[model samples]
Target chain A: MDVSFLFGQFLGGLTTAMFLFLIASGLSLVFGVMRVLNFAHGSFYMIGAYLAWQAMQWLEPTLHRFWLAALVAALGVALLGAVIERVLLRHLYGREELYQLLFTYALVLILGDAAKAIWGTQQLSVSRPPLLAGGLDILGTTLPTYNLFIMLIGPAIAVAAWLLLTRSNAGRLVRAAALDREMLGALGANVGAIYTGMFVVSSFLAGLAGALVTPIQSIVPGMDVEIIVEAFIVVVIGGLGSFWGTFWGSVIYGQVLSFGILVFPSFSIFSVFALMAVILIVRPWGLFGRPIR
Target chain B: MSRCRILAAACLAACLAPFAAGAESTIKIGFPMPLSGPAAVYGAPVTKGAEMAVQEINAHGGVLGHKLELLERDSKASADEAVRLARELIIKDNVDFLVGTLTSAEAPAVSTIAKENRIVFIAPTSKSVQLTSPKNLHPYLFRLASNTDIEGHSAASIIAGWKEVKRVAIIAPDYAYGRDAVAAFIGYLKKARPDIQIVDQQWPKLGQSDFTPFITAQMGTHPDAIFCDVYGGDFVTFAKQAGPLGYFKAVNNRLVDGGEVGTTDEAQALGADYPYGIWSDAYDPVIWAGDEPPEHKAFIEHLKAFTHEKYGSGWAIMGYSAIVALTDAIKKANSTDSDKVSKSLLGLTFDTPVGKRTFNAKTHETEMGEFWGQMVKGEHYPFAIISNPKYLAVGPFTD
Candidate 1:
């Protein structure tokens, strides 16, 4: 492929990678702190996308109102995550992870039917709030402003979380729990409250991830199934429970999708799997995975 | 009155009403369609249309003194569900005629059930060629909808006409529809345009939301065009993502089909800028969108009348057309008997918004050709309009 065309594919991969990061990061944070896979992370992402679209439609004033709406929509989804955790997920805390998976999967079915009942099985879209709809001309291709915004947001969230985790006191507790739950419990950290708080935070992150991608991809019923598959692939490739590892995994996946096809068209779809195989074979714990202490 | 006497009278009335309804009865038509699942988009329109046919038939003083009562159950597009529902419709609902099933998978299952029950089975949605092909086990089956053979020829011919088209990529939902559409499109295109290379062919499952990796892979090969047989939300999501990713713009042309253009609900999911140069078959509202080319005026009027009298437009009309066939067979037979109706339906022809739809006696496939359209700015329709339509019959379909 030529330079410009290759770059276009790279950009495409990067944009996709950003969403993967959002999903994987949330999934990782939950596992890192609470040791749950949050199989319904995809559902949260789906719900957030729908809710974000709904919120914007409800608040439709003008073109410029969208950026603010997008932010608020993310916040709104974060609140939804909090609610979901408090009401439903909290009950699963004392149970085994298998039960949690089943519960969340059940929630996926319920939420999907609920979404269909409320929204109908119609394909829904939210216009780019007018202001961000236009594209930037790059090497004769029009790159959507919304996509660029999404890619930018991935690193921004990653950095922000890193800072919060390292610099803040809550981050200390999170690290403490990540190190050893038994020790933290003995230290009188009110482990149950911390775990609940962790679940809410993880759900919020997943919701935010969904809200971020709405402008890039359309929201429809069953969006969760697709999004979750990609998220699972990323999380596995990056090594489970490693926050920053998700960052690298997304980029690697994006690049694989971009360059794999260029090199070999027929086998390209299997490219991500090939890389994952190599990663697992070479470093089964993932490039950055830490043993559970 | 004593309780026993009152109960006896009420039971007698209840028993006699169905018997009375049955004695003066029209054929009890039964249907099980995916009224709630992914296939519901097609099933809903089809059911509504068939019901309208039953209504019109019953309005004309019942067929041979029997008023038609339509019975329906939602199959949700699963073969298992369709079979279960079909059994219930046949055994309990006591339907004399059976219809429905949007998925080809469910089509034969229901048909087999109908065959065992000896009910005339007419599928309004299932377009799998094997349905009535003598090879199919159920000889009692018939469908008035065009099959994939005609679609393949039409699609191949459509691609041949495009100037910038060279290498064509195929992506379809990996099922009967997908497999058939790819086979037909490729077969015809190879025959029509030997120079045009058939590039990558990919099939994703139905209800799949992510097409990025698939689309990205196709884009990498840098094919001249992409043709998709994906429908419903699958089409909508693909279009929305593909449109923004410049997947359409990068190619010389793109073709999206599988019954999406007829409805606005899913079309709205693709947003305003639907592909302009792409070719897709649908009963386009464009005739109402008004460039008023030739007989389109009368056609538009007929379409509006039919739609208003049936469904607003699109699948509603398609469904209505299918029902028209079923009801017409019953009318001609002048009986509610399945054997009689089935015999009459053989070698049947009728006028519809989709043009003259006739079924072949041997194949039981509709002979009406498919229409292909180009996108244009139409006043009435929100999305692009389909202008140049093709009428290719079941001639090219062998399987």
Candidate 2:
């Protein structure tokens, strides 16, 4: 009956979309260049939140700098990502895609349990840095300051990633590989290094996304399931291989979430899933996606 | 040939001693809890409490001269898996009785199956009111833990006493537990204070990390107080994100209700300043001060020692009470039969870790009254320092 309520719902959906994009981009990068459908991608994001919370606790009393902690957290996760890839994932590259998917999927179980062990089954969170704790008080309605930070971070990361991919030789190799993997190998490129790089960057993106949202969500063990499920939804909806498509898909998803709640309180979550199903039936490869096969 | 025959005789005798001991030993109770899984943090302590109670009872000349033997299975807070484990314990392990299914959801599944098989089932941590209701129509089911009704009444009692609380806004997970809790709480409050207005109510899905929208919507109403019934990791998330938005601090008063908040450690982990001075209806997580009842003092000191020796937390207290309730029923019943045990459980009077517990035949569930406390130190062990809180004993509903 009311149009303004409809508009409010749209904004809510958009906010949810922004977070989904951050998760899907990294997942798509690895899936695009390498054939690994890393189910552990969600774990990386979960770890990012845990590590940031841990870092914040240690640094808060002494350093008083959340930014410093945030940076260190992101970098720490990146290093952790590289280590995991080298030790476990690297060897599995030549294996079948199903094996890679299954292996990473198994990692989800282990990591989920391990997090429970290390974190003691308690929920932990880092504070939003003092500068961003309060809302901007938009007109009569209030928007969370942390949300604005996330909204900006999503696009900023996209732009930075695009620049890196377009500008650097490493980026060129990654794109070339993503575009044509066998050709890159035939062209005298040591595709193994490229795969490793792509995985590291991808995992790093996951970690960064985790670290960024530390202020806004509590980190817990089973949290991986929730984050990963949402990540897959975004990846599938945005298309399996398109970064920009992932961005738009996230926007669409966020809107679905927000408006879903406003339009029909009972079925907001279901609405997004329904939209995804419709999209898949019409375009199996996703909105802007090319089929990997 | 003589040496081989003698060795065979020795092996048979060694195995038979325990079996022979079982005939003389108290009725063996086979129990399984989530000792090492997602719910282990809660399940492990409960096992300790139950085991300790079983040990204490046995030391006092056993349950009817038969020592209680406990066989525990790890359910890992899963339903199907828990039922499978229950079957293994019943048919394969041959546990004489079943005692626990950690979560509310899992309790019904295992209890339903156990009821069908004619085994007495007891739940330690299940807060769902469904198990004890007459709707089950089976006589073998029992629950030791207090349900949402007790918790809701606790909130109502506090609300009744408060001077500044008028209108309330409610937020809880959209699930059976959440709905039950909200319904019971609202019912109690309405009965206690007819004038209190409920401005807004928000129900978010379980395991959801985002609460900004709900928080925003609640703030718009600007109710004098807010009630949250969501628990576990979700409570932690709600508090953390809501804090950044300055919603809790800005709200005049708030009441947070969660099973996880029963522990001070969980509160501390959310953030040092979490629940941020909010009032909660939870377990009193401290060694009570002043001249206390002898039994209460002894219970507190014994639990402290057990916790220290076993790296335990406060959660072990409830499990300890379950053990107490079970033993009390067994000793009073003076029989080991499942039917007799089920009858003994109904209207049984017993000393419990949370205080005196009495079950109603109508509900088949015992009451462990709430421990109300405010968040203190916000982020530390023993964060909740409660004043002398009341333990209200009420009967189950007609349903």
Candidate 3:
């Protein structure tokens, strides 16, 4: 009700939005260009968190240890995405969309079980880097320095991703392939390479989100499935393939979830879905998605 | 044709042999538990405990001159799956007794099946009071864990002693277990400390990843203390997120968590991140500061060997006690009949690794107590351990 309390709530919403955007952007991009709803995106995110936890174990404790571990995890998951794209996803691209969906779903299950096998079922946690381990007082309310880092990084990643898609050659090629793969192929741009490259970038975003979330959330089994549901909600409400749509959707969702509990304590769980339903009723193709052909 | 007929006859004999031999030599106890997923953190250890009990009993010439055979099945923490498995174990496997189920959701459903089939069922871990509420209570079903009311009352007693605390905030998962426990806590707290004001209550969904909003909002109320029911990985997430925000410092470290966060599994998982001064409860503690009983010491040693881990889990005692109790009931009844076993289990006292526990004849509930203490950095172990724990017996509150 007061300025400080409202501001604190706003910051919390923004922090939630950042995490949602990080995971949803990759999912949206993959669907935009690849036309494949990668069900395994959350699995990639979970793997990233586990990999970072593993990296931290191997590395010496230092101020930059968390950052280094996150980078390692992101790269590791990106490489895994590339391999999966090449070995399995590539073969199913020309088939029915159902096949691709099933393939990705299968990947989710396999990766989930594989993570269990490797990490065991114990929940794992990661400490924030010493530089960002404390808090800062703003508007008479305390906000975690780590959360502030996420809020800043979320926008930076968004700008970087936008620039890659609009200003760079690879970006143009990917956009072209998303519009018409045959035309891009005829123009002598290796369509397969562009697809694989897009998948890797999308995977990197997911992995990064996963690694960053380790300091905030418990890295546990079934985290993959838990996150995928929220990520899917973000993407669907934002407009399936639109980058800015995903961004705004996450922003809306994060705020609603943060404030919903305060306003309607008993119905907070349904608030997100209720907003999604209203959006779908108003904008059937999402806020920014194109109408089906 | 003759050779084919001979092979078919041999296969039939092989299939029927176990059933024929099992009926006379073994008492089958069907155990359905969450062996995978998030709940597996507790479930896997619980199963190991049951296995250890069966092994020890069998080694000691079995119970009632019959080997106790455990038919363990993974319920995956699903209520429907647990019910289906319970039925399958009863009808298909012909298990004479039913035991196991981790979550509050799964236990009640399986209890219904036990009632329908007239088989004695003992729940080891599920603490929902609904499982044995007068409406749901049956002759066949028995609960080994302390129910929500007892847990809540115990928590309130702990909080009431804090003279400085007046305004309190509650945060728990928004479900039956959380709702019931918090309600019970409030009911008791009001009776104990009428001056205490309930400032705020936040019902986050179970397994909620983010607690920042709830934490901030609750802090806005400026309560002197908080009663938290979040447990396991969720608690780990909550503590890590809440720490940097000065949430603990804001409340002056007066968070009394009733979700058994004092257990070694959670303490070890959180490591140094665990809030040291907060009060919590656990069913068992591996490290006993006072003179450790030989029975407990031997149990811990056997558990370490059985689990193949350096440290024994406090959770393992639940399953171990259940099996031991079931076998003891069988020995008392002198038969595997459900009627005899169920009747024998009423008011039955059994020895556990912790201490002797008895099932209440009227309620079909065990008077199980828990160790309440403050979490502090351990001297020997890297994780936190309970400091100067006081055992809160369920008898006073349950009665």
Give me the candidate number with maximum DockQ.
3
The residue-by-residue lDDT of candidate 2 on B1-399, one tens digit each, is 999999999999998988887666557676767765446657777787778887788788777777777888888788888899888888887776888878877888888778877888878788877767667647888777778777766666666567687888888878778778778878877877788988777777877756665665556566777777867667777776666555776674366564546464465556464664566644435344334566766776776686574223556667777777777777777877778888888898887655577876777776666665655552323344333433443433332
Scored by lDDT, the top model is 3
Interface RMSD of 2: 3.0
The most accurate candidate by TM-score is 3
Error of 3 at B79 (Å): 0.7
Worst 10 residues of 2 chain A by lDDT: A1-10
RMSD of 1: 4.7
- TM, every model: 0.84, 0.87, 0.96
Report the poorest 10 consecutive residues by lDDT, candidate 1 chain B: B283-292
After the best TM-score superposition of candidate 3, give how far the Cα of residue B383 lies from its true spot, in angstroms. 1.4
Give the interface RMSD values of the models in order.
3.4, 3.0, 1.1
lDDT of model 3 at residue B98?
96
In angstroms, the error of model 3 at B289 is 3.2
Question: How accurate locally, in lDDT, is each candidate?
Answer: 0.71, 0.72, 0.89
Task: Tell me what TM-score chain B of candidate 3 gets against the true chain B.
Answer: 0.94
lDDT of 3 by residue, B1-399 (tens): 999999999999999998798668688899999987888888988898999999999999998788889999989899999999999999999899999999999999999999999999999999888889899999999999988888888888888889999899999988888988888899888888999999999988887867888888888889999999999889999999899888999988899998989988888888888888898998888777556678989999999998888888889999999999998998899889999999999999999877889999999988577888888888898888888777885322331
Tell me how far the alpha carbon of residue B235 in candidate 2 is from the true structure, in angstroms, after superposition.
0.8
